[model samples]
Target: MKQSFVYILKCSDGSYYTGVTSNLSARMFKHNSGFYPDCFTFNRRPLELVFYCEFTDINLAIEKEKQIKKWSRAKKEALINDDFDELVNLAKKSFGK
Candidate 1:
């Protein structure tokens, strides 16, 4: 069975970038090497792999990547820090609490 990964990178500018790939090492190398000039990480060189999760299903990995891409920075950080309580709190619908 093939494995897929959803990863997040911390850029030089202190920003985050989310992506999915089947080859984590190769993808990290490409991102750090500026393989794609127009890629988000290209300009934000010197990226650090902050977090990653593997899935046996590529479709599920892709779905997770897309979902994460829509998350706020705080939410992403909560995930990276493995703070499940914070993640759940962030996911709640705010009601001016």
Candidate 2:
């Protein structure tokens, strides 16, 4: 069975980029080589692979990628740091209903 991955890269500009791919190595190479000029990490070269999670289903990987793309930077940082408690705390609504 093939594995898919949802990955986050820390760009040179201190921003995060989220993506999904089946081949992690090739994808990293492409990003570093500017293979996709229009891609977020292209001009933001010198990207560092900060976080990644593997899934058996490509759909799941893509779904996770989409979800992470919408996450607040604090939440994403909590996840990257493996701070589940902080992640949950960050998910709470800041303002009252």
Candidate 3:
């Protein structure tokens, strides 16, 4: 069974990019090489692989990718730092309510 992964790349510009791929290493290479010129990480080269999670289901990975894409930078940082509690706090503190 092929594994799916949702990964985060920390760009040189201090921004985060989220993506889903079956092969994490290969995707990272593609991002670094600027294979997708129109991609967010293309111009923001010199990215570091900061976080990743693997799943046996592609749907799950895609869902996670979508969820992360909507997150604020602060929440993303909390996630990257493995701060689940902080993530929950930020979610609860959302002003949109």
Clashing pairs in 2: none
Best by TM-score: 1
Using lDDT as the measure, what is the rank order of every candidate, best first?
1, 3, 2
Q: State the C-alpha lDDT per candidate.
A: 0.98, 0.93, 0.94
Which is the better candidate, 1 or 2, if ranked by TM-score? 1
Q: For model 3, how does the per-residue alpha-carbon lDDT over 26-59 read when each residue is reduced to its tens digit?
A: 9999999999999999899999999999999999
> Which RMSD does model 3 reach against the true structure?
1.9
Model 3 misplaced stretches (Cα beyond 4 Å): 94-97
| Highest-scoring model, lDDT | 1
Ten contiguous residues minimizing lDDT sum, candidate 3: 88-97
Model 1: lowest-lDDT 10 consecutive positions: 88-97
TM-scores of the candidates are: 0.96, 0.95, 0.93
Candidate 3 yields a Cα-based lDDT of 0.94
What tens-digit string does per-residue lDDT give for candidate 1 at 1-97? 8999999999999999999999999999999999999999999999999999999999999999999999999999999999999999999996785
RMSD after CA superposition, every candidate: 1.3, 1.0, 1.9
